[model samples]
Target: MTAEEYQEDILDHMEHMEAETMPDVNSIDIQTEIQWFMRPYLLDFLVEAHAAFQLLPETLFLAVNLLDRYCSRRVVYKRHYQLVGCAALLIAAKYGDRKERVPTVRELKSMCCSLYDDEMFTQMEWHVLQTLNWVIGHPTVDSFLQIALSEVTYDAEVEHMAWYISEIALFHKEFVSVRPSVLARSALALARCVLSRSQARQSEWAGTYDPVVVLNLSNHLYQPSQVLSRKYASMHLSAVSTTVEEFLQRQAQIARRNITPPTPPALENQKPDADGYLTPSTPQKSHYDAVMQHGCLTPPITPDNEFGASNFAKNVLPRLYPVTPTSAPQEAPQQQPQQYSYQPYLQPRLAQ
Candidate 1:
């Protein structure tokens, strides 16, 4: 299929997946013991974990998917939340990473501060798989992003910027309810808006695409992802927030001139072939392969000087497990070694 056709096919599949897996907003109450506030922290830790382990982007997405789906079905205690999150990541690694890259039970246990023993983690891993019905192939925002971005200009920087924005979106609870395709498109549109604003001073026609339309679609499709918005505002990783502010200001200036905003292109519906699949064209396949290999079209673009697993473990891990200084170092010893006396790792759950 042509790039456009491939994009359309991916969009169709995303729509179906969204319908099949969308979480029910009404059923989710974050105000109880499980404060909605804790979710962002958990996600932040997961992102750090993803970077720390140098796992594939697909693995991170799958891990997050499992975390959300399992949480939706079960009433997880706040204490057990981190354990569940770690278990999900472990399961995802086994599914998406090569055997050599997958972390061992001991490694994951150490990462979780050894709060839960190996048996606890193993039980939670089995619980997640059972809760998710052993399905781990959901189409993530990253996948849709690759397809959507290929249709637009192929600027490596812009692609990385959109990816950064999308990854930020994953940290917000509101976005969990949004469709992956919509999130990917909105991120791309925002990236384009940012790029256009930067060149507006030199070129009269720099702001070709309409930011109002893109922002409006995003607002209508998903609840306000304030965490994501605030993160962009605070981080120096990119000028996305400033660009967005400038875009709005420019839009207002253009509106005063009575310039009609261009109508955004409607998403086209493309039928699948007799084989029930849309074979991507050479260029499309190449772009897809690049994303699979490199996670994005470009190399890592995080602004932090040392953005890796070690940095994450050293900096972010402490925040999650605050260290209290004791008079004697021996007074507060590290986690006790596991006895492994609990039931077998894969004990079957009792039927309801």
Candidate 2:
């Protein structure tokens, strides 16, 4: 979503919360109001960048979740939103991309339209790292949905439809403003509905947990009502999904309307190739040269066994379904717990 759309969505949500609960709108604003309103702005800013880069949807989704979960638990004052947003995106880049290079603080600032200075962005990044206790892994919507979908052996058509609906659901800011659990359930329901229609005659659909039940559960998360799954499915399922050909058509429309096409970073002086891979005027030195000559980087790891190959393939292949990596990097070894360090700048304010 664009920044304007995000701002309008949040304002509508605040208004709704105001009317329902009749909270004092003037005193500190809404009940959940933060003195630091910049956090949501930063989040919307990051979302626009991520969407522009054609980054993993899971990357944007998980990053936002981490930011929300962290902020919901702590208090951050002025200029802190930048820190949380950057840290969340960094964590997301790591988890979502096996070979994802760590973008420098400068690069992050550029991503945010240069709205933040390097020093301010760095401090905020540090604060987020500290707030998260420097741990990045968390259970995520992508994993959850993937796991749920894998339970049934649906056809290619079903798979395509399910993915289409899931993507469309994200564009609805009303859905995004709701609780994470509600959003998850809604995505699942949409996915299930698509799959069911594609395989209406199959016994697989019959044996699976009722799609209506899943959807009704989702609706209840938003408001109390027994929403009819068929009615919901009939109204939205076709509008949201289709076979592979139709899905691409929808993606093109989304790119034109709601999302910007993938573009090269600000540092890349030249336009990227057709596939959106950045190529500088002069190619950079290879990893081995950098490592051996300058002692700048680490060497690649060799897989030890077939079991390792199986594990890596299983973990990596499924995530590739909707988001394509810009460049393949050797998977970084998971960081050891002993080596974890939170940045000093993000340390919580000590009591006087």
Candidate 3:
């Protein structure tokens, strides 16, 4: 069997494995102490951490895969949530990356502001490996995307937009149980619609997706993760993030036009009531909107930052995490171990 001929078999096997290893998003309801709202904070932290190491994009996806699968199966303490993320990242890096690029125990500890020790990482890693029965080879969404992308004419905007949309899914629970193949296809489809490439060659590679699911994802994107947007907005990415924002803005305008509310007759045209005060015209636009209409909605372009990921360590790290070290008995630095629901860490952190 030639490699090309065997491709179908390979994909079929991966889909089967995905069904087995996929995390149950509903598994969060089983936990007593944690809620769904806490996930985005940890995921944001993971995104920044992933960028700092400059690891492969697939490494980040696999790490998230491990985190979700382990959390679904184990009764994790709130304190251990962040630790689990760190271990997942470590396992992913070691599994797929060059040894030199893998983060060290000390580096991981520092990243956590010294909240966890080497032993904790080791134990958690072993626990994760055991819970999943050492099944770390499940194909990630990125893999499925590569298969689809290979079938299509390459467009960097489409590629980056697809990735940007996929990363946005990581922060939301709605996407947790979505099949990797489905998510990849849906993201590609949505990317095509957003980039206005739908009439071009999209039908060749986008395949087909659930319209309801695709629309749901599209509506949910009115607000997107600023961090992921920045990651893909770099000069090399063709600033696909900006491309998406503009596309969505146009969509919003079209939606408004289609729904065109009764243009309230001009104030002068309306007959005044017996009470005498002129009735207010259609709900007046908010002052905020008035100001935004005058060129403030879109940020001015700056010299294109080559890769926003690199800025996470130097610029964003300090703002996002103000390390408050606890006093150690020995000569170590103080570490403020944040609770699992660390609200301070919730602010969107990423590059431009």
Candidate 4:
């Protein structure tokens, strides 16, 4: 196909896949058998696994999408959560990666410390495929992102930071409700915001943008994502957090000055407190409490292949989803820019 025709075809495919794969947020209830907090923990392990397996970004996104779709339709026990994740990963790899790169049944079992044997994983993989109706090739956020990024002129650092923010969004429940195209746009806008402030002088492409337009478009597209907001506020993980804080400060300033900013549909029910920050609604189980309650607060024991069957019950199951401590020292905020510039891009054309 011609280049223009190829782009149009990709956009058409993205719309179709997004419609098929989008999760129904309203249908998800933390009070059900699976808790809300468990998602983040599960996503954390998926991230680690993706890194360990050196899987593609598209693979990670597809795997998470599959897991969420399955969890939304079924009531999965916490015990089977890891199995579901591994199965999702295996499925995603088969579709998105080379055969040699996909982890074997034994490798996956070893990764879970043999709490589940190869047969169990095999069974679970079939179950996931059945639950998902064999829909393994649907488009993901990364798929939309690749197309969106192609429309913009960005440096490698900007691309990487945008990717980091997008991956972080995968861990947030609120983001699950967002469309893939909107998510990609918001991530790119945030990345540009960070890049604008950090640079001593703006690049040529940066000069062609207007910050107000970018922020407005992003705000209109994405609701206040608490998990994403808090994550970006942390200075330890990325310098982008500092930029986000400064960007928010400027937004608050504009609002105080009586400039009407476009509000997103998701944030209509969310009112900002006196500090102009919106706190997320309480989850059924807080992340920390869930970690403690599930014995996920400590590092997991490495797999011991030589352990006897008698020791299996004590040493294996609990280690499947171990959690690391959460801590990030606060840093002084950066100075706000006198003027910001951002240019909004067009959304992908929808199919008729």
Candidate 5:
């Protein structure tokens, strides 16, 4: 058989391998500290590292696949979370990338701000390989995308747009269970529509994937990684992210235009004068002027309120330009504790 035929046969076989080895759809269910939302932050780290090392696109997806598979089996602590990622990248680089391009453990260590020592990374790498049973030949979404792109007329924009959409899906937990082939096809269709390319070719493509399912999956692309968007904003990628953003913005404007404006109530009295000009009734004070006069609309200030004139004179002014010779310098106010949307990064771990 020819090389293309061999490659196609391998990919066809990978569909089965993916089903057997893919991480659990609700894999984070087993994780105690790692919530679903925090996955994006970790993904952002991986993207930056992937770009910095100049690794192949397939290597990045393979690394994430390994990381998720490893996490699926292991109990990863928060401190060791990023260490797992470093190990996954290292293993993926060794597996897929050339020997010269593979990142050294020291390079990954430095990328991680030296939080993990050389021995720790080595241990983690060995641990990940053992957990995965050395099954690292999983076909990623990018592999499927290549085949789809090849089947149709080639456009650099479509390739970049489809890849950008697929990368965004990596941050989403919902798409984890969906097959990469499905994602690749849906992303290509959406990219074509965004670029206003012909859908004549897609008529054949739709028969394979359900239109409802493809439409639903397409909705998830609305949210993408900001870091990845900026990465694709370069001239090299044809700035497809900006194109998608403009498409969404134009859709929003069209939706706004369709909204019916509220109608004014009909007048009861006949009020037109000699010149036939129906003059508006009485002039009213501008709401903005009223606001300026009233200040910020706080409750009528009592003597104790900080912003009250008397209190400002007595306390605020002195603090602003303190003339105190030495009045036992006032204690600074304690700030309220900040509330974070997600768990904070690793606190210093004690040496074992």
Candidate 6:
């Protein structure tokens, strides 16, 4: 079971869940709740972009996840959403596949139909890296599978099952909806499910097949649904089963869309700086892994000057325009009236 094959199942589950669970856009609060929809929108965009461009899906998914998490923790002003989204993608591309080039602002603008300004994108790329503390190193899907393989009994069949399930789990972003930690647990849960099942022992298989952590992870992923659902009293271990159905439906939609007809636009090499807006530069790598491990808010890029601010300025600041302070028009000084010029009705004289 290669990662590719496993990704398919994961994707299937994701599609179903998204359709069933995606909150109605109309119900969302535009001012306060836009981030929730923005994350999914960005995720959807990336999924389409990866297919259209033949880029890696894992990289795109991981990047979008990181972006979502970052936004959840920090406030992204309305104007900066595109910048933040692109920055997250840039970071993901660097960390997930170091060899891949960060997409240029022009290229990304083309991808996004020129919705974002180049300087804004560049600034966001830097800001996200700063907040993340340049820590991209973390236990990825490959690492988690490696751990699972080492722990399980050494059987070729078990190894194959683990590989198959883990890869498939990647495609199902729902399994990892909470975070990397949840993702690791769900993959292990899936692997264990496959390995523990037996053809002869039907009841035993049924008992062992239920995923413990994936349900918990699913709860973490869909707290809104779990909390609000009238059907379930307290969302327990059984919720994943119910949610899994929803996930697969959404995944199917994505798959169907993937299979649909193509639209053609002549490809053009994006010339780097067409506009006078600051030239786009590659984003600096941040220590995201260290920041996550530490669990601190003031990760290198905080407003304070503790962590190097020079990098922040270079990476995160919008291009500065020279403000040549219009010399305040020189004002003429008014003369003061002499104290004795105006006499009061009853003025008192000093005695000699």
Query: For model 2, how does the per-residue alpha-carbon lDDT over 243-350 read when each residue is reduced to its tens digit?
Result: 323534565687697766577667745433433433346654432222333332333334643224665776743221224447877888998678777867776889
lDDT (Cα, tens digit) per residue for candidate 4, span 1-352: 6675688777777777788888767556743666777887777677767767877888988898888888877778878988999999999999989777898888888888899988889898999889878877777767766666565554665666666667767766767877676666567666766567242124422233345434544453234334444544545446554555576678788778786666666745443343333334755232221233433333223454323454677665543552575788789899987997888987999999
Best by the lDDT measure: 3
Q: How close to the true structure is residue 228 of candidate 3, measured as C-alpha lDDT?
A: 74
RMSD (Cα, Å) for all candidates, in order, is 42.5, 40.1, 37.3, 41.3, 30.1, 35.5
Candidate 2 pairs with clashing backbones = 83-124, 127-346
User: Given candidate 5, what's the lDDT at residue 25?
Assistant: 58
- Model 6, total clashes: 32
**Alpha-carbon shift of residue 217 in model 2 (angstroms):** 10
TM-score for each model:
0.56, 0.42, 0.71, 0.58, 0.71, 0.41
Q: Supply every candidate's count of residue pairs whose N, Cα or C atoms clash at under 3 angstroms.
A: 1, 2, 5, 5, 0, 32
- lDDT scores for all predictions? 0.66, 0.49, 0.78, 0.68, 0.77, 0.50
Better of 1 and 3 by TM-score: 3
Q: What is the per-residue lDDT of model 6 for residues 1-352, given as tens digits with 9 covering 90 to 100?
A: 7775575465455445433322223222233545444544455565555444554435655565556555645666766676676777777776766464556668787887887878877887787777656654443444444444443355554434333333334333344443343354455555444345332232321122335655543343233232223222224323333444465567678989999978888668544332233422656343232322233322345544434576565686522332455678998999998676675688789999
The stretch of ten residues in a row with the least summed lDDT in candidate 4 is: 284-293
Candidate 1 residue 119 C-alpha distance from true site, Å:
1.2
lDDT value for model 6: 0.50
Give the runs in model 6 whose Cα sits over 4 Å from its true position.
1-33, 53-58, 98-102, 149-182, 191-210, 216-352
